[model samples]
Target: MSVFPIRFLTLAVIAFHSNSFAASGQEQQLFLLIRQLDTLDTLVQSTPRFEAPESNARYRFDYPRLTQDIQHIRQGVKDYLSPSRAQPRDPNELVGDYRLDAAHAEPWP
Candidate 1:
């Protein structure tokens, strides 16, 4: 019956909706980039190979350029998809109890 709960519920709902929208936008952007890559693959496959001098040079250049472009795109995608790393811990913090004495610890009988 308190107003605090109602306010908290409203804020929670707003945050949820905002997160959903942001996630959907990111998904759509990724989908578009994938589609673009698919189209590039199709174009690369459909192009005809040539035995002539000029065509050969162009073809050679095209492949390397295509490879570089694909690498750049893949790196971009990886950067976008990868999660952030955890923050580093302080070295001064003790992880666990390090008891040196054998008698003080529990002995296995």
Candidate 2:
């Protein structure tokens, strides 16, 4: 066997390995982002709840929905990272609206 073929095979293997390492680096960054998202979700859940005292504020922060959206985003990223196969895309879009109208209740007699 000629030495030239052996050298070429070695170089090809090294190049493939380097490419895989580069891909893994990108994957690692994405994984870090997912972790941050999880932390944010936890913070959102722990947020203190308070009711405005007869306030006329038009909009208030919708904490529960915001948490749900964060979960959805995390799941979407996870699915993208490890997709089982080509699947149908979700038609529903993120609401992204954290502010909602504050509900008014009739004062008890």
Clashing pairs in 1: none
Off by over 4 Å in 1: 1-23, 51-61, 84-109
TM-score of 1: 0.39
lDDT of 1 by residue, 1-107 (tens): 12332243334334433544467786565555555555654554444543123422321223334434544554455555663665433244222222223223232
For candidate 2, the C-alpha RMSD (Å) to the true structure equals 18.3
Clashing pairs in 2: none
Error of 1 at 51 (Å): 5.4
User: For model 2, what is the error of residue 58's alpha carbon versus the real structure, in angstroms, after optimal superposition?
Assistant: 2.2
Residue-by-residue lDDT tens digits, candidate 2, 20-62: 4466785775676577676666665555555453466776666
Please list the C-alpha lDDT of all candidates, in the order they appear. 0.42, 0.59
The C-alpha RMSD of each candidate to the native structure, in angstroms, is 26.4, 18.3
